[model samples]
Target chain A: MISIKDLSKVYGDNVVYSHFNLDIEEGNVLCILGESGCGKSTLLNILAGLTPCEGDIPKLRTAYVFQEPRLVPNLTVLGNLRLIGADEDAARQMLASVGLDGLASRYPRSLSGGQAQRVALCRAFLFPADLMLLDEPFSSLDLRLKISVMQVFKRLRENKRITALFVTHDVDEALCLADRIVVLGSGGIAGDFSNTPSEKYGGNSPLRERLFALLSGN
Target chain B: MKKYLAENAYNLAASLLAVVAMWLVWIIAYAAVGNDYLVPSFWGTAEEFFSLFAQAFFWQAFAYTLLRTAAAFLISFALGLVAAALGVAFAPFSRFLRPIIAVCRTLPTMAVLLLILVWTSPKTAPIVVTVLVLFPVIYSQLTSSISGVGGELAEMARAYRLTARQKLSKIYLPQIAPVTVAQTGANLSFGIKLTISAEVMAHTYTALGGLMSEAQTYYNLPRLAALTLCAIFAGLIIELIFRLISRYAFAWQRRAEA
Candidate 1:
């Protein structure tokens, strides 16, 4: 249960947002979809309380997956999860979910890009936060590794029933991972779509045509 | 082979040129003066040097001086590392100690010497001065090494909620060791010069400084030259020892650079 009203962020002479609004219901996976530099991450940081912007956000425990892994370089894969108060078993399970089961003792520098980002994801899941924020956490991943991480996120979503706001420039990623998708354009919140992946249609169904038409005001 | 030689060519050349220039100067000056009094002939100094290598007393002095230097290094290193660790973990307390460290750093060696000479025995005077002069250098190096570890990793450690001791050994310690080891050569050399100089002044019986002093008093120019050259050789040995340490203790650095 999170809500934002009339949120705006300005940096020097640049205006990232003016009166931007978002409402996240419980157990919903909402993604802020946008092109690069559309301030999706700035909005996520604001919600994480890592940045100050004009808005009143509901106070709740939150975990964020930054664009980079942001895992502690010195810590082992398990250790990062331990930071979020995960116990030995929960940390192991979360790492296993991300296919990092055997990497518990390895440091961030020792991990591959995808593995490190997955460790960051495991950290977020392990935190037991009511709200999760992901800012293009999978951007650096290749197509093969990206699918595995997406599956891990899907499992996390199914289990936690936690409200989440993931930001990404890729529409396909937004489609596959989100329960509801909000497209942020030059004006912000250009289109909001209810995404439902079922037995009938895979959520990974391409929305390129519809989204392009929608964004272009066609 | 080419890359290896290319990398070290400058150092090798410079070292060779320095030896050649020193040899040339000695030969020309000895011939021109035609006197062993002004500056002993290179052959005379070399003979003294060769002769001293077989002398038990010379070896004993050399051994004692080296042992004291090693002892001073170890003691000062531990003190410096601990103080730095405390400083990094608790900045407020460190800030409180900052002025004290500054006073130690800036206080005159003569002042330290004159002050400590009052209490310590003549034999211990040089060791005490070495520790005092070296303590500041080492402590200051540790302080910077601690600070140079920077805030990002520290915050990461905090988020991990590491225990006080865990934070020190894991996050803080490794990051600074390479830097601390780097400061060792400069600090050791600093300590060596001061300690040996003090030894010369205090006339300690069991020191290389005492040997130099004895040479000066007896007008044994060859012995003085020989001892001076021995000190230089000892210094180069020290540098080589630390270079080997740098290779191992800072393996992470070697990896990154490689």
Candidate 2:
């Protein structure tokens, strides 16, 4: 479990967050859902200790997948995977899992956007970390690629039960991927919900409607 | 296949045209001067070139000069890599090195050669001068490229807990290889030229520059021109070899570009 308290972040004249606090349970997919510039990615960066913030964050080994793939352009797909200590067989298997088989020797520049992102995802998964951070990873992906990528994440999550903090503005992405959803607004938590089976399958979940209202500022 | 052949033929024609132009200029100049000592006939210079090729002393001189240049170049290359690494790892040290790099960049190669000759023996002076002339160029190139390795990749490396060696070989080298290849391509010829120039100034015993200087003293214009042409041929051959090696070394980049 990770706990953050009294987080305050400011950049010159712009105030990003003030007295922000969050708690995430272990082995849970917690999505920080928000609109543009709602401090979602900033929160992730703060948690990762990349950006300056006054807060108490739990000491967790973290793997981050940025909005861009951020791959070494000169390295082949498998080479990038091996950087994180994945061996040849494991790297190849991971690539195949993301539908990128036979691309082990291809450089990042040679890969399509979707394929590159999948490589980034594989890199994140291959790293030995207690927590994973994703920043708008599927935002630039097409619908089909997004779904396939989501499935990749789903399969990995099911297999490893790795704790994750996924940040995004997409409502459907949060609905499909997160075990718990935390909506951020006005530099603080606006709505927080934990999903249950019936809430996902039953006629119309109040949680979904409430989340929509909260997101739209109704 | 036809297009490729046509391209090759055109290239050959262009090269021949260039040679013909040079020959015409040499003939015209020789005709105007009417003195073999001042302006050798193209045929006379050509004959000297062939004769020089047959001489063991010429090959020995060429080989010795090449060996010295390669030694100096390798030293410069190694020191430059270390300097760049130190600069990246420590900002204060990098700041300390900037002025020295600037001086090396701006100082005349001849002046540096003379200064080096005062301390080093004539035999080693050329090597020292070559390093001085080339170190800043190679160091600056590597430092800038090393610094430009993105923070994102660094962070990624950290997240993965990559060992220092892993980070260097996997991330730093891959990122820096292109710029390094480019700088090496441009500087290799310059390094060779500087080495020969330094050899001449230092009065090195077994070098093309020494032979050229000797020819100049005796007014052996044809022999001088022949040696000069040999130097040009050496530079061209070295450059071509470097290009081929770089293409092979960074083949992944070519693939990505393709």
Candidate 3:
């Protein structure tokens, strides 16, 4: 289990998190749903060790999928994967898994928005990391592309049994991918719910209604 | 292929038109002055320019001057790159360098040349002065370019835990190469002009500035104009060479943009 205990983070006059505590089970996909400025990204950054926090945070190798693909423009798709120590065959295999096959030699400029994000997903899975920290990785995609890319992400995450903390403001995204969903509010986690197989597929289940109410209240 | 050829032809014509316009201005100025000593006729300067190609001493001086400019440029480029890299790595060092760069930028060229000539040999003074003047410019350019390497990309690299070598080769270098190459062309051209001015101030013999000084003393207006023209031509040639190199070296950048 990855644990964050008594995590305190401040930025100038703004107090983002104070003595926040959370425990994540191994191989569990925890989706953090929150409105803007609710410290969702800060929590992920703390977990990824990108932000300094005063707490006992576990040291684990992390793979990050940012809002933007963040691929090196000059590097080919495979080359970007290779940058983080992915071997040729593993990178190629991972690319194929994300439906980016035959684009190993293509640069990021050539890839469409959805395609680039898929490569980013491929890169995250290819890395030998204990945890994956995704910061609204699909926020920029249109609905059609978002669904397509989410499907790709779901397939890869299940195949790898990735322990990921997905941060998003989209309730549908949280329901579809998250094994457990936590809604971050001004105070702390305002709502927590387990996403069973039945609730995961339901379009407007009681759980979804509850989450929407919790989010709107926060 | 046809479009490429047509584009090249148009560029060539545009360049020629500019040259012709300059020649016309020079002709007009010469006619108005009607004094060979002040503004030599275009043909007179052209004759002297062509005659310079036949002189062994002129060629030797030309070669020496070119060598000095090139040496100054290379040294300044290397030093600027190292300093910029250091500045990027350490914030305090960057702060420290800010004042030094300001001093270099604002130093009086003639005073610095005089001080350098007293401290070093005349032959070396011009190169030293040129380096001092050019280093800060190059350093500023490089610092901005290196810093401009996207913050997002850097964060991604750090999150991935890429090794230092991998980060440098895969991220820093590629991101900065195209901009650096483009700026280098302008920097080298400016370096040549500075070197020549320093050489004249230092009274360095066996150099283009020395030849210009000799021509001025003899009141050979045509030769002086020819020497000035030669320096301009050298600057143009250096700029063109570097521009071509940048185009060839970073073709992928263009392709990506396209």
Candidate 4:
């Protein structure tokens, strides 16, 4: 239900994206995979209308999770969610779903990095949005934390069926969370593939090998 | 609870020790000077302090000075907060107002007091001078704290689409509150002291400073010492009250640290 065409972004003699185009279907989890500085986050910001860019984006209410949790440091976890209009009960329930149930009254400074990211996830899920944009949301997580958070994302998507555009560089992260993965090269889409985790093979899977090779610049 | 009581008891002991040390120095000086006009004995000042408690005039003067302090503080604090908010919200306006605020901050208190005395009524001079002296303190503290709010957090607030009220109460207010409380607590005593100094010069009626001036004219060193102690106590009390408020207001912060 979302499409971008001829989107361009420039910052003082540096061009990040030139005539880039992308499309995301309704209720699909699309992960835009890219290396650092390849405009994965810029694309998300353009979609969120946070960055000034030449593009046409759908006027949809979108919730965003930055690379940092960006939780208000002075507010309790519940208060941060409430800042986005979540009632105590709904916020508590979502916090529970994300394994942060009893941390509602805790301030952001007291939380571990992984727990804080989970709170950000809970925030995005708690706020009913037409589309959720996550920018490298799991880049800081360890393997165990990453798996746990990815599971939470999977569960939230399964339950809500919300359209989400996830921006990240990790190939494994995209494979775990995305229904369709689009690899973002320097200027635009370089590799786009349909991903179904249950049906995809292990070890020598052609799709996985291709993705790994593309990421390693083979 | 035991620990809390122990801490209070320790504080009381320390204060008593300090008071004893002060009395020892006072006695030594009194011995050396041997003149009540120049250096009053500790017992003489103590007598004056007790006598002043029963005198209605002394209480009236004390009340008058305290009321003036409260008025000056409220006016300065309110206007300072408003100015700081305006400065933070509008950059061009802040730039326009910066030199004026800087003048207030850097100008000598006595000079500002003299200017106010010349331009304003003596009755209002102390309050006006207090504001001129203290407003910059509150303004700078607030503006700096507000500016310290990170851009990333602002972006987060926008992404969440928080209402203006929500953004303030939830984010900006909380972020600045600790610093505001600290600045207010530290400056309040100084503001009150400046108010008294202005009052002495302005000849504001029924104020502690006017009483002090009268004592000085009469060469009543014991009464002057008693009055000075009273002023110090009043300042201590104000600082204590603000400390209590800061403690209660930031109890959540304490909890997080714990």
Candidate 5:
């Protein structure tokens, strides 16, 4: 579990967030949605302790998948995996999980943007962290890759209580991946819409148009 | 294969032409000056080159100079790596050490040579000079490499609970190896030059710098030309070796380049 209370940050004259409070539970995926320059990524950085924050973040280790893959270009696929302290076999397994089994000896520069993102995703998941902070992890991925990686996460969350904070600009992505979609606007946590609507709803509760209408009308 | 050869053939030809043009200029200048004592003709210098290459004394000096350069590089390399590791692992230490590196790197080379000369033997002066000249190069390179190893990747490492040694050997070292190789090329080439320059001043026994200094003192033009050629050849060889190392060490460079 992680908690943020009344977190505030300013740059010169602009306020990023003020009196901001958030709490996350283990095993559930929480998606933070906002446009560019709206401090979504900055919020993630503060949680990861990359930014100096007025509020406290949990002491437990959290894996962050940055907007950029941020992989060392000189390192091979296996080398990148080894960075997270994964064994050689574990590295191979993770790569295979991401459909990168043939590119073990390959470097980041050799990989396409999608493949690089997959490697980054695999790296974060392979690392044993209490929380995984994903900032647009699949933003560069094509349709098929996106769906596949989402399935990978779905499979992962089944047996493991692996908490995640998946950040994205896309409303659909928030719906597809997150268990609880926290609609963040200029009002950050404007609405807490549960995508996992039970029984007859079968998880894909409200349609995109209906959700967009609710967000706009509000 | 054809594309590769076609791309590189132009560079080879251009380099060849440059060498030929330089040789022609040397011939013309030497002949026009008509002063064998001051500047020997092309053929005369070429003969001396062959003669020096065959001499055991020249080889001994060359071996001594190489060993000294290697020692200086190894010393600076180890120190630079340790300093960089410390700087990266601790921000406060990096802040403390950065200014010292900037000052050392920017200090006058000739002044450093003079200071070391006063404190050490003629032979040992070259070693000290080589270290001082090379320290900044390796240190700055290593620091930049380490600093560029971003916090996001480091957090990923932390998430996995990687041991300190694993973090260093697996993550830190590979990230820095390419940059270190690049700096090694630059520093080693400079190291060879610095060692030779120091040798000229100190008149260290069995160094090409010593040979050049002796040539200058006695007005031995052919010997001077031969020794200058020797330095160029040695510097070129060292740079080529580093070039090879960079290619193998950083495959990502090749991948991006292709």
Candidate 6:
């Protein structure tokens, strides 16, 4: 389990998080749903060790999928994967898994938005990280592209089952991918619930409604 | 291959046209001046320029000047790269270098040459002056390029736990290569110009600047014009070589553009 206790983060006059505590179970895909500027990204950054906060945060090797693909422009697709220690065959295999086969030699500039995001996903999965921190990885994509990329992400997550903290403002994304849904508001986690088997079936409607209400309340 | 050859041919033609335009301007200027001592005729200067190749003294001076310029450039580049890297790695160091780089950038080259000549020999004065003049330029270029590696990429590297060697080879070097190459070419040419000026002032007898000084004392305008032309051609050749290196070294950039 990954634990964050007594996390206090402040930027000058603004307090992003104060004494915030959360425990993430192993192998659980925790989706953090929040409105804009509700400390969603800050939380993920804290987990990724990119941000300094006053807390007892577990130190774990993390794979990050940022809002942008963040691939090195000069590196080929496979070369980018190889940058983080992915071998040639394994990188090729991972690229194929994300439907980016035959693009091993292609640079990031040649890849379309959706294709680049897929490569980012491939890179994140290829790295042997104990935890994955994804901050709105599909936020920039159009709806059609979003759905396709989300499907690719879902397939990767299912295969690896790495503990992930997926931060997004999209309710549908949370419902589709998250094993545990968290709604962050001004005070803290306004709502938290397990999206169990029953919730995936008929219970989804009420759960979605409740999440929407909680977000609007914020 | 056809397109590449056609492009090269067009560029070569354009460059020739520029040279012709320069000669036309020189011919007009000579006519306006109407004095051989003031503005030697283009043909006379060209004859002198070609005849320079046969003289052992001219060759020796050319070699010495070339050697000094190269020495200054290599030293300045190395110092700049090391300082820029340190500045990038440490925020306080970057802050500390700000004022020093500012002073170096604003220093008067001739005044600094006078001071350096008083302390160092005439042979070494030009090299020192060129280093002092070009160090800030190379440092600023490298610092900007290194800092421009993008915060997103750095964060990504950190998150992925890329080792120091990995970061340097896979991220920093490739990101900085294009800018560094262009800056290196420009600085080298500028270094040669500054070195020549210092050599002229210091009266370095075995350098191109000393030859120009000799021509000036004798009022041999044609030889002086010829030496100046040699400097111009040298600058152009250096720029072209670097442009070719930039093209081939960063071929990935060209492929991306295509």
lDDT of 2 by residue, A1-218 (tens): 68888888998888888877788898888998888988888887777767777766676778888888988877888988887778889888888877788898888877888888889999888888888999999988888888777777787666676889999887777878888999988847888989642312224567778887988998
Best-first order by TM-score: 3, 6, 4, 2, 5, 1
Candidate 5's residue-wise lDDT over A24-105, tens digit each?
Answer: 8777888887667778888887876667767655766778787778786667888877777679998897777667899888
Summarize candidate 5's per-residue lDDT along B74-192 as a digit string, tens digits. Answer: 99999888888788779898899878888877878767778888888888889888888788778778888988887766865654566788777767787777767766777778888
- Which candidate number maximizes DockQ? 6
TM, chain A, every candidate: 0.91, 0.91, 0.96, 0.93, 0.87, 0.95
DockQ for all models: 0.20, 0.53, 0.54, 0.54, 0.44, 0.55
Ranking by lDDT: 6, 3, 4, 2, 5, 1
Off by over 4 Å in 2: A196-218, B1-20, B256-258
What is the TM-score of each predicted model, taking all chains together?
Answer: 0.71, 0.90, 0.94, 0.91, 0.85, 0.92
- For residues A1-218, write the lDDT of model 6, one tens digit per residue: 78889999999999999999998999988999999998999988888888988978888889999999999988989999998898999999888888788888888888889999999999999889888889999999998898889889878876777888999998888887888998999999899999752222123578889999999993
lDDT measured at residue B198 in model 2 versus the true structure, 0 to 100: 85
> What TM-score would you give candidate 1 relative to the actual structure?
0.71
Arranged by DockQ, best first: 6, 4, 3, 2, 5, 1
Query: Tens digit of lDDT per residue, candidate 1, span B1-258?
Result: 698689999998999999999899999999999978778888889999999999999999988887778788888888877887788769897888788778777878766776778898667778877887788778877877778875755544443345777767666776666656656766676666676788788887978899999899998999999998888788777777776687675433441322
The residue-by-residue lDDT of candidate 3 on A136-203, one tens digit each, is 99999998898889888878966888888999998888888888999998888898889852324338
All candidates' chain B TM-scores are: 0.88, 0.88, 0.94, 0.89, 0.89, 0.93
Residue A160 of candidate 1: its Cα lDDT? 72
lDDT of 2 at B45: 89
The candidate that achieves the highest TM-score relative to the unseen native structure: 3
Over all chains combined, what TM-score does candidate 5 have? 0.85
lDDT of each: 0.77, 0.83, 0.88, 0.83, 0.78, 0.89
- Each prediction's RMSD over C-alphas, in Å, is 5.6, 3.2, 2.3, 2.9, 3.8, 2.8
lDDT of 4 by residue, B173-223 (tens): 888887777667667788779878887887777888888888888999999
- Calculate the i-RMS of every candidate, to one decimal place: 4.7, 2.5, 2.2, 2.2, 3.3, 2.0
